[model samples]
Target: MFWRLLSTICSLTSCLNAVRVPGYDYFDDSYYYELKNLLEAPESLHGARGDHPREVNGWGPGLELGQVSGVSVDLEGRPVIFHRGPNVWNFKSFNATHHYQGEDGPIAEDPVLILNPDNGKVVRSWGGGRFLLPHGITVDHHGNTWLTDVALHQVFKFPAEAKAPDLTLGEAKVPGSDDTHLCKPTSVAVAKDGDFFVADGYCNSRILRFAPDGKLKEKFGHFGGEWSDSGLYVPHGVALDEARDTLCVADRENRRVVCIRAGLHHHTFGTPVRTLHPASRARVFDVAIHNGVLVGVSGTAEEGNAGGFTADLSSGEMLGEWGPLQGFRNPHAIAISGDGSALYVAEIGPNRIWKFTVGKTFLPTKM
Candidate 1:
């Protein structure tokens, strides 16, 4: 009755705090829930994952880590992080109509950086003043780096230690729908047979397949017909299962991961075999397939600390998840170590990369 009287006399925001509220304050309620979760969380789920808190000294002062868009493990097992440089949060929201690339063009900063996994120190850095938007990075079998730029609407392949890209796809800064053009291409999945797939994202929802020599071969996927089925709403991430000839895509808006097989000899995409949806709704952003285990990061670039999960690619069952408690915020990209011993997560909101030790029991086949 007292709260109702105050509401009638004063504005809601001004008067709402007058009502005594418990479990909503920083000093008391926050700690209560934290303690509650620790005491009541099941041991099986709680024990599934663990990590060290954000370390103080890893990224050196020379490298100003911005909005990290992608992360991958190189052939040498070092982490390669692709970021937007200094200004971290450029895009207002995930569904924003226009990506903020500045009035003149992309900011002048280094986009590609290699970091030491042991202490988060910058081992080397390059790709400065080249990319309009550094969105995704993938290290292929031949020790080459594949990157995507959403602002430039292009994809590139750089041979090891080469400043210039050996192969470039899509016209520089030109967005289009034809075979030669791409609209906000997100990620590239390179197959063992040398064929590659690109998740053409943002404005266009499609997948383009190319041959070993960079010739357009085939294309599949469509925009927004159904969420429960094969259609892709926002194909943000792509990964290739070379052993199985399978392609996995993170359908961002649809909140699921789609697995499709590729006919390598025929150069065609097979029917969608499985769609893995998390127990909770998430903006599925990136996926990394390691040893038959699908590790995925779920969150947007705008909001922080959603989390990441692991799933069995064969059965599509979720194995485990860790997040907010683990200090994940806007997990945009992820990569597994070459030996499958560590997981590297790149967060956009906080502009940092976190390292998590993979549990020994997380072997895909065993799960």
Candidate 2:
């Protein structure tokens, strides 16, 4: 009754204190929440500032950062950034001239590095001569670091603390739309059972599933030959909700997130569940799940609007957004901490990454 009365009063005069106080209940609570604070806390939207990474080391000075494509957190909560070497300008400008499709060469610099979580200093680095176009990175349940290289048309899995990749998918430097081949795969997600899904993107529009032993299990979606009911168009990122057995795909060109019920052993998409559409419809580049909330990065469209948004973890409804006014630009990949407390957004335009803390204010309060 108190909340209802407060709501009715606010609707009438657009202010919370406008109503007569029935009692001192507002002053009795230890946690005093101002009306503006309650109004600013979104029930579904999420946003964060970009100045975080810059406040740390390494990001300052002349140390170069090139087209920061992918970022993932290690077991120790440190950020593992995948960049295209020290020649930052070349990689950022290449998209204007050379098409990543059919490119056969690796980027000339080691592109993988681990940064100190507190100071942002480069603690370790490797993978220099491996990837042509480093795309997405994911840290699995077992601590293995998996990454995708669109220019090489391949995906790689590096064992925890290892310098080289132990598992490789797709033929090296070869592009194809076959069971044994991947065409510029974009992102990957691993289930609790070790089975994984890949977003075969850029050149092909399909979702590929690989077994625990790296053998192809099942592949779905149409590759521009014809439209199918699969509901995938330019699938760019893939994430698995192990608790619900759900697979969420960032269908970039479609400007929506598609959720599907997937059975690992069945090797099939059970049924389409929900499709989440952001308010801006700007290329939904990547997604991460934290505390049962879906956090996403939507890059600036041609009209020059961009943002980071949060949505209902189940329904995919928009909860909130941070627009260009908040300094979001050219965001590509996203990753959340294991504890679901921190979110990382890697941006290509500014060649930087931002960190956000997750809270429960956006969630519905229990009665």
Candidate 3:
């Protein structure tokens, strides 16, 4: 009788613990509750078949890294994504047991670029010697690739065919320091006349402008939390609005996207025309403006953090969010297609890239 009573009490405790809590159901499913089922028994579902398991699509493999930091669609209509890993040399360094032994050992360093939603082919790969920690990538109209390495404190411009960069700017000229020159540059944007802008993000909070000949034309912004024309707090991403002649800056820590109107007086950053502060407290990371809409990726505060959201560009309304999709594990950067038909996200922790077919309303739909 005592054993029977104890078993009943244990069952009741389990039931109580499983009770649904409001706003705590991070993963909500409509049909079959597949995500819930997977959460309950992850090992059993590892190789099982389903409509869409988290990682692959139709035999296309995903990326391999600690986290993916940036993504862009190439001129050939291919999706290229970049990853940031903790260890630069051996994959074993990623394991906690071996992490300390290799603190300074030939740290495995290389940023991976994959052509996804297209059979997982690595069409081109570069930047092991170029970057200590690669964070962002953008292609100019001339078909050249521009990449930012926060650790190396430099921005490299690699021509289409060159294995190494044809032009190296910023910290490449001076080693081992974060100055106004290019301290941890995160994002890059090219103008029509061949000039470019680099968001010297992360440590030194300023935007550095360079002319076509690679000369420092001017620099603006400072490090601050205020919302005035004075400073920027961890500016991570940047974009150029060619038609509006404006510069869109993703002031990440401040939780806002600030617009610098073109033809305005120099060093003047106008008020944000659109703000994307959700009540959930997620912070904005990388942003891209396409088709008159602003698309961005929001990240949680913790490491190995999964589950991000999207918002409307014009109204800042909650569009839709997915994941905790295959244990997302820290989605860092985002890119949208020209027509807004697809949204590509880079999962930095799991070292994978996910391409979601945006629904008619610009949200992810179950495949």
Ranking by lDDT: 1, 2, 3
Model 2 per-residue lDDT tens digits across residues 1-367: 3466556654655243445643344453423234433444443343422111111212323336788989888888878888875433345523432345433456666688777665567788888766777888888888899999776678999998787888899887677887888877889998878889999987678888888789987776765421344756788888887666678888887777777776754434646767787887777888876545677787664447577777776655567775322467688888877766566778887787766655545422221
TM-score per model over all chains? 0.79, 0.76, 0.69
Error of 1 at 28 (Å): 26
Better of 1 and 3 by TM-score: 1
In order, the Cα lDDT scores of the candidates are: 0.75, 0.70, 0.60
Q: Best by TM-score, which number?
A: 1
RMSD of 3: 10.4
Candidate order by decreasing TM-score? 1, 2, 3
Model 3: lDDT of residue 5: 49
Clashes of 2: 5
Clashing residue pairs, backbone N/CA/C < 3 A, model 1: 58-120, 305-329
Q: What does candidate 1's lDDT look like per residue over 211-313, in tens digits?
A: 9889998888888744545578989999877666678898998888888887664434856768887655688999988777788888653454276777777
Model 2: lDDT equals 0.70
The pairs that clash in candidate 2 are 44-319, 44-320, 45-319, 45-320, 110-128
Across 1-367, the per-residue lDDT of candidate 3 in tens digits comes to: 3345445655666465668423323324432244344444333222111222233333236445555668877666667766656644345332332112234322255564647455766676656544455678887777778887655567888887677887787654232223335666789988767788888876667777777778876666788874665478988888776665567677888866666654333434443455555334456677776644555666563634334445444455655444433455456777766555666777555566776654444422221
Which parts of model 1 are misplaced by more than 4 Å? Answer: 1-63, 87-101, 104-107, 265-268, 300-305, 324-326, 364-367
Model 1 quality (TM-score): 0.79
